[model samples]
Target: MIRIVSLLLVGLLLSCDEDVLPKPNSFLRLEYEKATYKSFDDKEYPFSFQYSKDAKVIEKKKYWLDIYYPNLNATLVLSYMHVKGNLMFLLKDAEKLTFKHMIKADDIQAVPYENTQSKVYGKIFEVYGNAATQIQFHATDSVSNFMTGALYFYAKPNYDSIMPAVHYLKKDIVRLMETIEWKKEEYF
Candidate 1:
């Protein structure tokens, strides 16, 4: 009886030697394929630009388009407006749209872009944190054309989870801003 009790005590003591710990939370690892770009030139639209081939462009209206990324579950919403003496208002509206996310955004960085030769001037707004839109930009010819784009994901705005996708699409946005060309000026 004594030997059995000693063995049971030893077993209990050994079992308590280490405090069991819950495993650390594991994060999902996401990987995406390299992006290939293609030019989008339509005679109907005032501007033309390049976009990722992985995306499908859907024309919403005469001047609006939705660039859908099926793999990333995101969309780049593009709207082209005729700048008829209301360039300031158009630009102000674009900036207003970006700042609307300020409540949820941790930071908003405005990066200016100017291509004097191409006559494409714009500002790209990078919104950091779990905001509704991760990126927003506007390109204009300062004469007759204005274009604004916003990047949105289908999933809930979890900045960390969607950061990889945001980074990928951001390159596409920059490319679009860089390659945008205004066909001609048709002032009203």
Candidate 2:
């Protein structure tokens, strides 16, 4: 009887050592660098606004620029085109650009933004899921200057992984929209 009891105790101990139960899923805790913004205004440029100091402004060509976030592996592309008389076409092009990610995106939500005081009116698109560009917007004076911005990450479009960075930059974009001032002289 004592031998049977010992065997039972040993079995219990072995079972405990084996750890047969599955471990719960866990995710890495990701923390991103804090952001601080500074005003961005160039006499040559038609508009002025604030942007994250963490990002570098790269001018591809005159009036065409990119806000690059190296640490976050992202870039906000700013495309400038003369409206001339094709405001509808410009608006449509911006919409098409935002929706291009629909094949990979779970959803795209447009949050309307209008700063009547600044004369910047546009729609900000928040894209969910694994899309190439997660955010985009267009600001126009509805005459000569039409500018569109799109936020794209360098890495693969894994929405879950980059959400925090996206959230942080979203605010910077909002600030940019809020502060945009179109130069009457710069307009063509």
Model 2 agreement with the true structure over 108-145: per-residue lDDT tens digits = 99999887777778999999999998889999887777
Q: Which candidate is the best by lDDT?
A: 1
RMSD, every candidate, angstroms? 2.6, 3.0
What is candidate 1's lDDT per residue for 1-188, written digit by digit as tens?
A: 99999999999988896788999999888787887899999887778899999999999998899999998899999998987899999999999999999999999999999999999999999999999999999999998899999999999999998998898899999999999989866523
Clashing pairs in 2: none
Q: What TM-score would you give candidate 1 relative to the actual structure?
A: 0.86
For each candidate in turn, the TM-score is: 0.86, 0.87
List candidate 2 stretches off by more than 4 Å. Answer: 1-3, 6-21
